[model samples]
Target: MSATTAPASEIQPLPPAENARATRETASSAAPAAIRHYLSLPFAAVLAGIARYDSVSFWPVAILVVQILLAFLCDRHIRAHERMEPKRWAIRYALLSAAAGASWGAVVVLWFVAAPPANEALFVLACIGVSAMEFIARCRFPYGYAAHAALSLGPLVVLLLLQAAPSSFALAAVCICVSGSLILFGDTIANLIAESDKLRHDNIQLIAKLSNETREALQARDAAEASARAKSTFIANISHEIRTPLNAMLGMSQLLDRADLEKPNRDYVKVMLEAGRGLRTLLDDVITLARDDTMTDNHNDSDPALAARAVAQLLQPHAWEKQLRLSVNAPSTLPRVAADPRRVRQVLLKLTENALKFTDHGGVEITVGVDEPDDDIPAVHFSVSDTGLGIPPDAAETLFEPFMPGDASYARRHQGAGLGLAVAKRVVESLGGNIGFKSEPGEGSTFWFTLPVANASLSGATDDSDADAEVTPPSDLTLLIHTGKLRVDLALSRILESFGNRVIFAESRADAAARAARETFDVIIAGTSDAEMLAATPGMRAPLLAVLFPNDRSPASGEQILHWPAPPRTVYAAIRDAAIRKEPAAAQTRDSQEVAPIDASAFAALEKSLGLSTLLEILQSYIKTAENLCENLAEASAAGEWDEAGRVAQDIAGAASGLGLAALTATARGFAQNVRNHEVEDAHTLRNQAQLIVGEHARTRLALASLYPDLAA
Candidate 1:
């Protein structure tokens, strides 16, 4: 369709202005040479054929001159058409055609009178001219030019050619009409072919554009996801690195508490313990934030109670220090949920800590409940609301954004990174839940999140209200506590007692000295620097023993001390050696060699018991899924779906976590987090690193399993 085409209602008899405009539009879209050749070729051929009739015949010369004039007119019209409107061009062309027709009609009538029964060769030449002209015109403008040229020129030329042959004039007229109709038919076929070709070309372009966009999109998404995963990994690694040393410090301080240290020594130990706890709290927050930032739609709602409990334990000290009331309103028989336990705890603890921070007089409350629904899976809602300072309504939405606080002056009044709500929101959303709040200024706030329950609780799982003992201590060996959380001390005490080990508690070195003064024991276990005071106090009799923290370096002379870089187990082993009669060297060597190489695969039995096989299966499935992801990455990159690619990478990270590929899990988690944070520029390297970790972990696990066959089983 032409741009000048009007509606049917607006369609009027062809006026010169309208026709000229239409012609110009059509001409501008086509090659001028094409239009000229179509219009002039037939006339030139007819005139040349007539020229053979007589060099002296004035009719032939006059026709040749008129043909030259017509050609000139066509050239002028085409040039003018470039500057004029389509309607104007069309009108001019129509006028030119009429003028050419009138002149040719006069020539035809004159030729019939002078040259009756014209040569067959002349008529053949005219026929050929008309056929060639129509063909070329049809090639140029299939719909308009070709139809008009064939209709006007074909029949007229044939009739003019036949006029010279009286006997064949009637037959020629009939034949001309048939030939004109045939030209019209050929034009239609040609138009259809040309249209189909144009359509195919358009379709190819559209598809190519779409594919390119899809690929670009995928690449961008992958990049973003890779960045997020890197961030999560960094958080986890940093947390672990800090935690190891913190554990040692806190442990030693706890041992100091048991010793009979002077007030200054006891106070110093307490300060160190508090600092270590503070560091732990900070690390936990970072980890939670990282995990939350990397979460996606497919994130599981089930989180381990043990892990979540660990986070809560970290914040418990902070709450105690503040002297704020705190209570966990979890169901007596709360079910586990399919969520990132680390993230969930982070969110809850953040809310609790925030509540405690602002509430000088009120207590913080946390409730964990399940909503019964028609579906098989139950929804568990955990709400941590506090009677602390409430959030302004206007700032509610922005509060979840990083660095945006409830009050602009909060930084001056309270000390925090202002990431609590942001982290909480991200964590909740990641765990397939929502987080919301209700608060009034100067009143308080309530923050809540909901997730699906992982499984029904066992009857006895909730029997131990104070967190069930997780670590089991060895029996037949004397145990000593140096320093650590009260709960850890309590748990360790219970575990050692259950194992039939004699357990002793001392707040300072002086206390241990008093115990030693009264008994001649097999071993004396010292927790911290209090060992110095304990050693100074002349013990009655016992092989002196000291329990070293993971990073503890100080040593007191005349005492056998061991640093438990591997913690409790190694500490107990050292105590056993120091307290009991030494086993034969050969037996000690055998024991040491027996437990070597307990790597990832060695824990397969435990893994399966914990239902981690599903994770392994997912890892195995990654070979296929990853292929799809890669393909999707390419497509998304081409399509410019950067966000989608990031999501895909996150999926891979989560799957890696299930397989117990911690390193890989960290890497993927980092990438996903970075993407979510809009840190995409660094995505490429991160994603590659993440993939490598996953691959390496898989191989490491398999190799370890191979070395220790029973471990895998």
Candidate 2:
């Protein structure tokens, strides 16, 4: 697992010089401790020899004293100069190791020579065994281990060989072999440790190098970001300065064009306005480029014909100024597209203006139509073609770059900063549209874009291209159109106003009710779900003409339902007839006061037949029953359920007639008949009629007490 580990075959034995250097490091680190440990044996032996024999062991004491002094001196020398080069530290370690080896050897020699022959032989065996144990214990060094083994075993072997016996020579040979094998084993271990040390040093260097590279990369990125921010701030300030003067130019030129002038002079002023406006847009794109900003899409249902025709109208003056003809080629059959009208107009206007700017003597054409469907998602395509200077070859690559004038001279005459094409490309891409151009030199260029379409909020119920004559309301009918989208609100208002009704705008039912109380509105056009909210507002008695869109499940709503499709005007006749009122003002006023307090003859006859008390109780029951029937009939009629409304209306007629309320009976009969004929709008009038009858009944109840003087009480 360690990076320093190598296979047995990969590990090479250290050479003599390196082996000696490494072994000396191990001796300086660990040999002095071993020498001090050996001193303990001398102390133990001296104590035991003095205790068992009645004699003092001066030699053992002397040897122990010398061993202690030698270990202390060697420890002090190693600590004095701890940090040393390998070669110099190796020489110093060798000298200290040799002293430790000789000191240990002297202890062995003293034990063998001074002890009795019987004990000396056992002591010599103990020395040989301890030498082997020391070699195995301190396995980390080669040179230090070799010197210690040699000094301890060499003198003992030679002394044994001098006995001139075959057995002594054999013992000497075994000692020699043991020392040499131990030195070799220590050398191998030292080589492994040295190799691991080198690897750790190399890895540290590599890590430092990688860290430095990562730090430099982060610094470079921060610098680039800082530079970009500085550029954006500078461009934003500069564009603001340029646009101020350009705005003045555009305003002055517009005012001049409006003033009285000759035809040629007016055309010149128009050209000036177009150039100034184009320069302002170029400045806008400069800020966009620096900040990488694009137009915020305000999505709405926009008609292709409206956007194209609007742009065409805007560029007509500039086209005339250049003596070039400009036209819009579009069909009335085009569908309304869900798009941002502002951006669409911007793209169309800029492209058309560009075409006019490039064309010298020929015409520029703008065409719009539906492209081939992509998986049933509607797509609208527009192409602007110019008969002026076609793009040169070199300009094609950087055509969409900022300040890119395909031909410098033509761009200079056109007088824009030249970011129009680039900004247009960004706008198209942001809208998920495709934009490009096909140009042929000496001919013309056609710049085209394709945008995916979605269904407009207004349903495409029919494609009626013909605009009908405006409907003039027979009476002054005020209408409120409640919707958010401008195009939808405008289109619906135009359709309703075609009948010549004054239509107004309202944010909500409460707002409409407040305005209606102050101003007269004959009808409110709103969603059916808002029926309760609309009912809560005071003074809104007009029947709601609920507008339905695509995916609307409720087929019919209210006394009239206006289903707005392609041409909102198609619902003209139904919406008008339901909204109109046919009632005499004087008769309605008189009926409200006199309808409820019927002459007492009707109650008088019933009171004579029954008792006065019984007649009064019966009259109360009849009023409660009639009120329920009238409310049910109104609800059913509003929902366009003629069958239910008629059924309830019959109950009202029977109940009113049986109770001797002649006016209510007559009104209920007429109301029932109107429901049978499916003239539900008349039901609202019928409802008003029943309310008056109910009001008249309340007055009659009050009159009985006032007139009969509680004949009752």
Q: In lDDT terms, how accurate is model 2?
A: 0.61
lDDT of each: 0.54, 0.61
Off by over 4 Å in 1: 1-276, 291-324, 328-346, 372-378, 392-394, 405-414, 453-713
> Lowest lDDT 10-mer window, candidate 2?
461-470
User: What value of lDDT does candidate 1 attain over all alpha carbons?
Assistant: 0.54
Model 2 root mean square deviation, Cα atoms? 23.8
Which candidate leads the pack in lDDT? 2
Q: How many clashing pairs per prediction, in order?
A: 90, 6
